[model samples]
Target: MAENHEHGKMDITEQEKTFEGFVKASIWVAGVAIGILVFLAIFNS
Candidate 1:
């Protein structure tokens, strides 16, 4: 039973790390997309 609890905690920690990584990646992607859009607008205008 204790082993199972420990395993569960490990799983949760891994999941949290994965989620944080995804969030960071998404923010980077969004920033790049916004930068591209702004550049295009300036160039087109």
Candidate 2:
């Protein structure tokens, strides 16, 4: 029915937003981890 189609669209939109947020967070974490490793190498050397 039309109602089910509308609900499915809403669910898809919500999932997309959640996935985008997760990707952004993962990138930030990776950047921070790399920064820390570089700093450690510099300090140890």
Candidate 3:
């Protein structure tokens, strides 16, 4: 286990970017879904 112990030495730029993008996409999708639901509710009466 000592041979693979790289504490605080791993390069994670790509991973960080991917995670940021994923979070942004999730927020956008959730917002769009809520907007669509609201539109339907307000118009389907």
lDDT of 3 by residue, 1-45 (tens): 799978899899999999999999999999999999999999999
Work out the TM-score per prediction. 0.73, 0.73, 0.88
Backbone clashes for every candidate come to 0, 0, 0
Worst 10 residues of 2 by lDDT: 2-11
Q: Write one digit per residue (lDDT tens) for candidate 1, span 1-45.
A: 655565434547878899999999999999999999999999987
For all candidates in order, the CA lDDT equals 0.87, 0.88, 0.98
RMSD of each: 4.0, 3.9, 1.4
Off by over 4 Å in 3: 1-4
Residue 27, candidate 2: Cα error in Å is 0.2
| Number of the top-ranking candidate, with TM-score as the measure | 3
Cα-lDDT of candidate 2? 0.88
TM-score of 2: 0.73
Q: Candidate 2 clashing pairs? A: none
